[model samples]
Target chain A: MSGTFYGLGVGPGDPELITLKAWRIISHAPVIAYPAANGNESLARKIAAPFIPEDVTELAIPVPMRREREPAQEAYDEAAKLIARHLDDGKDVAFLCEGDPLFYGSFAYLLDRLAGKHPTVIVPGITSITACAAQIGRPLAARNDILKVLPGTLDAERLKQEITGADAVAIMKVGQHFEKIRGVLTELGLAERATIIEKATREDERITRLADVPAGERPYFSTILIYQGSEAW
Target chain B: MSGTFYGLGVGPGDPELITLKAWRIISHAPVIAYPAANGNESLARKIAAPFIPEDVTELAIPVPMRREREPAQEAYDEAAKLIARHLDDGKDVAFLCEGDPLFYGSFAYLLDRLAGKHPTVIVPGITSITACAAQIGRPLAARNDILKVLPGTLDAERLKQEITGADAVAIMKVGQHFEKIRGVLTELGLAERATIIEKATREDERITRLADVPAGERPYFSTILIYQGSEAW
Candidate 1:
């Protein structure tokens, strides 16, 4: 009598950006799991709070956003086993993903363990790239233009190459690596066209051009979108 | 007393996928516009139909989907002027885009004409890439994996080169270009890993592996996602 394990995408920073399917699941799922950062209230759970009931049992997987996820694999592994136990008890477990569960989400780590054994569904959410683009009133790419969505976690050399070949580029996870990514965009002569967004769709969201952004540490949830608008498509 | 112009992203196929912001705008906008194929009911309009009142003034922007849009620039220009007219008359116009209005969306064309003159806001929606990934329960990319979103409108040579350089690829508008993109994936030894999704999140949604898809005409809403999972990130 095991129940389905659902991975819900709550979307980027906005509570209302969650899809109807995700909202339905969040409201009804008896057992829910969300990744928390160093014992902090989970961002995914926060975005889904409007839909989640007070009675649902919650499991918080401690996933550090400031550090590499490989080091946190053991924590996720244990979380999966605990979640599987709940599934075995016939209680549908909704594991909230920050964005699209498959898009750089921590839920992928859990899906590897739970998806095969239990019924699983991944509800897609609005990505930071698009949300940032909307906030900036800039098109990501159009008319045969190729958009390369890269991670700022990449080495500077690889980041430079990826930017050079892209018509449009959106870099995610630009926490402390903003300076490195900014350098690549500069080398490729795209720094002026780049827009950095922090906590997109949130009330306190910030949008600034690369050239205007002050030198400092950015929040963990940020995206850098660079458009080569002059390129002939 | 000119009115505000908004670019609303209705989301990938699901009607309920529309965000609360978009829903709020769509319900109250004096005029709404959406890209239509010839004289048919617009797909964007259909996704947003739930919010649009029967008496709301509708503007159908005829944008050909079966052919390249370069040849249809005049149509978009005309549509933009018509929308601007509504805004000039103190009417808030909500132009519906299928996905994120700024993420490879047709709204960009209208924004170029409207945003400079009238107040504009772009509401982000769930991208087809993420929605397709959700439908398949696969993440688009994770960690440092670079996701290349290429248009099927590209030349075969360019498409092959792009695919080779990408850790993950999602090709948009795979209508008649399915075979061409399939060939490129086969050349890159990624045909087996490629998944084709038609009308993702729709009632009659179809999901098939690139290799297993029968030789036929794919829908204009189709997407082909190729993942290079063997690479060590």
Candidate 2:
């Protein structure tokens, strides 16, 4: 019997944010896999550690975070093959992902290679965008409002145009590019309404105004959201 | 001593999609409030029913869905006053929401009145957008790809502008305006790549290519997601 491959999204930092379906599948799966880089622990596995069983087989796919600097094509290629072995033996394997699997998540790479060849299921998780919006205690957008999610890696000029055209904006992957992103928001007079959320839904979560966060190194797990038209506190 | 007010998102249609945090708070809450319309049972309340205690007090705010025919302000006002009484008595109240509460949810109206006056916390939920994307087994947007969330209620021209300007789009609230939205997607040559998902993540969920759904009444819990570069199945 060929086994099923489950792509489970364990959600953001908090373990409690994981859904019931994800928890159930994770706790009972015969084998599990998650992304790791440079021997660092996978955030997805950490968020799900409380629910994962004690005896399940574990595999780590070394997916480099900085894909631009170090291509990880060969690593993913090898990981998919190893995963196939477990499935061929009729052992179900659950691939854990941080956040929603298909929303800018690393799981997409694995899914692309495996979905076409086997029975696969993608279980969605809560997004950090919604988590940040929840932490802000304000609606991201209302009726007929436009929401633009632009990557911070975009050229500053294009970023500006996209930000200017939307009613609510969430800029992802805002690592060291915080200053440039903030500058664009400042130019658009949205600096005050903007919020920098780090590790949202976690115990040590920090929320600050864009103006207050110093221009320096930012945490890898961070996002900038602006609900324009509201006066800054 | 006043108690905290929790605005929890129970997630889309699947009961298991509710987060552990939401379940914990809802189960322990002294009073539970949810939005109901025209005597129809509240979807949020239904999603959380398995976790809710039998002895807990339930408050149904009759928020009419037909805002054009019957404004909902008066109903919300009355509900707020009733909720305030619970807060005034130092009893913790948990307000349940269908999707993410801060993302175009009915809970926003209550939060607008209670947020500043009382200590409130917003617990985010799994968005239907991400759920639908996961069901389709494709990335919503990756790398520098732009994601635009445009409401189907927008004027045809504005909806067209927003849809054309992004690499990926999720058209929400696709009720009676399905024809217009479908027309725009067809004009943009994206109909072949679009997927209509109803009640994602739940039993009896339906996923269909946008071009194949016959001309008929679309479900309110449905959304149309289009990944511009892909072909529809």
Candidate 3:
């Protein structure tokens, strides 16, 4: 019998956002897999720590983000090989992802490689956009409205066009692109309506209007939500 | 002291999808407010059952859907009055919503009325689109791709135009308009690329290729995900 591989979403920051199915899988799986940087603790593993059994074998696949495509591809290929070896040993493995595995998650790369060789199940979790919007006391979009969720990694012109066209927009990964995204929103006359959230749902969470944020202090995990309507107030 | 109003998203169906922040508010709030139909239990309240404390007060505000504007507006006014009465007592209240409170949620009606008078917090939960995509092992969109989340309530011709223009699209609230939305997808030559998910992530979850679903079995909770790119496969 082929061992099952579970791609579990641990949710955005808050540990309790994990689904019942994911919690159950983590507790019962004989082997647990988490992505980490070299010599770093896995964020997903830590979030799932309370549910993970002490007896389960823990495997950390170090996948460093690289500017070069070859290194990243090689890392994914190696991680798939490692996971395959564990599956061959007949141990059910649970791979922990911070949010929905299929939503900009690294697990997709591994799943593509392990297709048909193993049984896989994906457990969805609360996405960061919704979590951020919740903390700020704003609805993402109302009835008959359009919602566009995009990464801040896109170019400023494209981001501006997309933001201007959307009824509500959630720009994620607002790391270094903070100023660029802010400029785009400003150009589209949406800066005043935008809210910034950092480390949402966590104890250290901060919510502030985008116009109030100082330029030098923006964090990588921060997200900007723009509701392009006067009624948002 | 001013009483706080909580907009808690109960998630799609699974109780565990509710965030820890939402669970905390639901447990400690003096009153739990939910939308219902003539004293029926709210679906949001039921999904939140596992986390709601035994001592928490339950307040059901029946907001029936109506074809006419007068009845719907009247329902919103009545619901607002009930929530205001609880706030007058200086008691914290939690209003339960099934999905993200801001995403086509009826809570918007109450929020419009109650926000200025009370301190309101919105707790975001998992939306069905992400849940559906996860269950089917499909990506919502890739890097720099345009994703449009539309409602089936839109006219079929407009929906068809948007579907054709978007790299990926999620058609929501496919109730009486299932056939119309299906027709739009077909007209855009996207029938084979679309996937239908009903009651996603729930025990009753059903996923089918858009072209293969039986005509008579479509439900209100069903949503169609369409990705036009050939690379989606």
Candidate 4:
């Protein structure tokens, strides 16, 4: 019988935010796989470190930081082949993801490659949207309100239209595109209602108003939440 | 000093899906509060049952089922007073919430009434959006793709507009509004791309394509995920 492959969501930065189901799977899995960007340590591994046994076999897939998709696609293709070997040998392999695996997580690459060929299971975890909302102590959406999750990489015009239409909005991946997103929100007269939470649930988490962030400063691993609901806080 | 208040998300439906942070706080809480719909057992309490100590004081707030806001507001007002009494006595109160508290959760009602008066912490959990996506083995959104979370209670015309604009969409609270949402998705030629995950992560969880569900049959505790991105599954 082929071994089962588990895609575990380690959650958004906080070690303790991982689900009990993920914890159990990570603790006992014979093989562990996670994405590492170039020379940087794997954030998913760091989050799941406490639960991972020291003797477990580690497979770190080196993901390149690039704009084009070919390099990353090749990396996932190679990693899938390596993970497939373990499953063929009847060894369960667990792939750790930073947030809920299917919520903008890189685990999708591997899932796409290995799902049909192997038995698979996915355990969801706390997403950054909820984690950032928790840090700000505000509801993202309530009652009949619509919540929009936009990538900051989107064009300014698209951002403005989405923000204008939604009651609550969470703009993510706000790296260099922070200025563009801020410009759009300001144009829509929503700058005051937006709050940026950087590295939420982490030890060095920072929360700042969109209007207060320094000019030209781009914070990665950050999410900006805008509340335009009836009970805007 | 008054005892701190905690809003813990216990995850969608599975008991084991609760995060380690939520479990820790729940296990050690002196007073645990949860919202119950009239005489219905508190879903949050049931989700966190394993961690809850037998002798822990439980405050079951009776949330009435009504469209009007006053009756529910009054219930929360009364519940807030009782929870405040526990906080005043330096008893740490952990309010259990289903999924993430701020994401269309009733815990927000209590948080609004009590946050300024007490030190509060919110532990995020696995949302139904991610859980449903995980169950169906698909990413909710990936790599700059916009994701919209809409309430099924929204008017059909408004739902059509929102669905048309996003690359990925998750329609929640699909009880009586299932037909309305299905109609919108079908009209947009997205019915084939949609999947309904009912009570994801639970033992009785069911995954049905939009085309397979019977006419006039509505499933509560369900989410409809529609993907229209370039890499749509």
Candidate 5:
């Protein structure tokens, strides 16, 4: 029988946010596949440490994030080859991701290459947007409202248009684009309604109103939630 | 010491989808609260069976879905009373929800009443829309695209406006509203691009093109995913 590959979501920062399905799969899988930088430990693997069996094999795929295209593609290809080797040996492998595997997740890149060649199961987890919204006691969207999830890297004009048209917006991938996003929000009169969350749901999580946040403190993993209408409560 | 209350999201379906945080709270909480009707088993409680310990207390709040306003509010008042009783006794309670607790979840009604009186934590989960989308190998929305989540119970005109403005839409709470929603989709020229999923990620899950789904086979848990733009792939 061909070995199965499990794409498990470990959830946003909180270790206890991993799904029970993912926990079971992690416990039973003979090998665990994790993404990391070269010679660095896997964040997903470390978060899932509580439930993993001590004897499970670890397969580390170092996926470096680079501005250039060739290096990233080459890394994914190499990782796929390595995962295939374990499948050839008939060892079930579970690749762990921080949130939902397909929602702006890196696992999608690997799944695109490895799907159909092997049986795969994706276990979804709590996305950070929802967690962040809940942490701040606000609903992402309410009845008859529109929600838009935008990557902060988009051009300012496009981001402004999307934000203006949306009843609620969750801005993700906010690294170097923080200032641009802040500018767009301010231009659209959404500065007062927006809230920024850095490392949400983690013990060290910070929740601050957009107006109060300093430009220098923004992190890439952080998200900004903007609600133009009534408060959720 | 004051006790806490948790509105935990179990997940779309599949018992294993309960998050680690929810699992840990469910396992350790002195009292477990779940919605039920006429003494029937609670679906949320059933999904969380794997992690719930034998010794924990169970509080079944019968939250019947009734059209009568007085009865529904009464149920909420009574449920709050029971939960408050536990809190007064210094016992933390975990109230389980099928998907994310804040997304059209009845737990919100309870939270509105008890949130200030007691310590509460809302743990988010994977909503059915994402689960349905992932199961069908479809992206919820491409980069910078507009996405809307609307209840199928909305008037057709309102639904049409939201659908027309969105690059992608997930129409949820779709049971008897099937024909109405279908009509609106057809009128908006979105019928061809829609996919319907019922009981997503569950054992009896069904996914099909909207045009092919037979009438009278729809369930309330079903969701319709409509992609207004060309396929990203």
Candidate 6:
């Protein structure tokens, strides 16, 4: 009989943020896998390091750093094959995800490849959006407010249109596109209301006003949360 | 010196989904508070019941069941005053919230009242959005796809406009407005693509297609996740 495949979300950043369910599964899994971009240390693995069994077999899926899709698709394909071999040998494999597995997480790509052939389970984790909101001590959305999560990679015109209709907005992947997103928010007269949080719940977390961040100074692992706070809950 | 106030997110329905951080705080808290409508058992408290120390002082914040704003506002106001008493007596109070405290949670009401007067720390938890996605084994959003979270209470015209722009959508609070929201999704030609998840990660969790649910039948504690698999992510 084949072993089940588990997609475990370790959480946004803080080690203690890992769910009890995820911890319980990670402790007993026979084999484990995690994604490492360009051979860098996997954030998900690091978050789960304290709970993982010392002698468990570890697999690191090396995802390319390129912006193109083909290379990353090939990596997930190759990793799926390796995971399948373990599953075929009747050893359960747990794949660690930094956040919720299917919420823009790399595990989704792996799940798409492996789920059809094997029994799979996904344990959700704390997303960076809520983590950032918690750190800022502000409500992400309350009452009937519509919350929109936009990618910073979107063009300025599109970003403006989305933000215009949203009662609250969270812009993810604010690496190189930080300035463009900030400019759109500024043009929409929301610069004062927006807050940028980098590496939320992590040791090096930084929370700053959008207006305070200097131009061309792109921060990594950042999300911009825009809420007017004018509505009563 | 006054004790610190904490807003702890206990995660979605499943008790095991509680984070180690939240569990840790709940275990050691001198006093615990949770919202309950008309003295009903608090879902947050139920999710956190396992970790709470038996001898710990429990506070039930009685929230009235009303559509009007005045009564609910008064309830929160009174609860905040009572909670302040514990803090003033140098006893730490932990407020339990289901899902992330800031994400459409009632804890936001308490946070606003107590944060300014006391030392407040928010411990983020797994939101139902991600939990529902994990249960359904589907991606919430990937690549640059925009994800919009609309309240089912929104008017049909507004829901249609918002859904039209979003690549992925999660319609929350689908308690009584299921039929109206379903009508909107049908009009948008997204009825086949949407999946409704009720009480995700709980013992009685239910997953049903939007098209399968009968007309005029409203399911409680539900969320509708709509995504088109046409994008290669």
Q: Which model, 1 or 5, shows the larger TM-score?
A: 1
Tens digits of per-residue lDDT, candidate 5, A36-107, equal 877777777777878888887888888886543234677888998899788878888899987677666667
Give the Å shift of residue A126 in candidate 4. Answer: 0.8
Between candidates 2 and 5, the DockQ winner? 2
Query: Model 4: which residue pairs collide?
Result: none
Clashing pairs in 3: none
TM-score of chain A of each: 0.93, 0.95, 0.94, 0.97, 0.94, 0.96
Deviation (Å) of B168 in candidate 3: 2.7
Q: What is the two-chain DockQ of model 4? A: 0.71
lDDT of 1 by residue, A51-170 (tens): 889998989888766455354667777888999999999999999988778987767778877888999887788888888888888778876678998888889998887788677888
> What TM-score results for chain B in every one of the models?
0.92, 0.94, 0.93, 0.96, 0.93, 0.96
Better of 1 and 4 by DockQ: 4
Worst 10 residues of 1 chain A by lDDT: A64-73
Tens digits of per-residue lDDT, candidate 6, B139-159, equal 998766799998888989999
Judged by lDDT against the true structure, how good is candidate 4?
Answer: 0.89
**What 10-residue stretch in candidate 5 chain A is worst by lDDT?**
A65-74
Model 1 residue B29 distance off true place after TM-score fit, in angstroms: 2.4
Model 6, residue pairs in steric clash:
none
> Which model, 2 or 4, shows the larger lDDT?
4
Q: What is the DockQ of candidate 3?
A: 0.49
Could you tell me how far off, in angstroms, the CA of residue A86 lies in candidate 6 after the best superposition? 0.8
Q: Which sections of candidate 1 miss by over 4 Å?
A: A69-71, A216-219, A230-233, B69-71, B216-219, B230-233
TM of each candidate vs. truth: 0.93, 0.95, 0.89, 0.97, 0.87, 0.97
Off by over 4 Å in 3: A66-71, A215-218, A229-233, B20-30, B38-41, B50-56, B66-71, B215-218, B228-233
Give the per-residue lDDT digits (tens) of candidate 2, residues B1-233.
Answer: 67788999899878988888899999899999998888999889988889999999999888878635234677778888989899989999999998789886777778887888889988889888988988888888765579999888888898888777688899898988899988888898888889999888778799989999898856667999988733211
Q: What TM-score does chain A of model 6 get?
A: 0.96
User: In each prediction, how many residue pairs overlap at the backbone (N, C-alpha, C within less than 3 A)?
Assistant: 1, 0, 0, 0, 4, 0
- Whole-model Cα lDDT per candidate? 0.83, 0.84, 0.79, 0.89, 0.79, 0.89
Candidate 3 residue lDDT tens string, A1-233: 66888888888887777766677788799999999977688888888888888888998999885432234777888998898888888888899988778666677778777866898887777788877766776678776677887777778877866676577888887887888888887777777889889888777888888888898765677888887633632
- Residues B118-171 of candidate 1 have per-residue lDDT tens digits of 998887888899989989987788876789999898888998887886778899
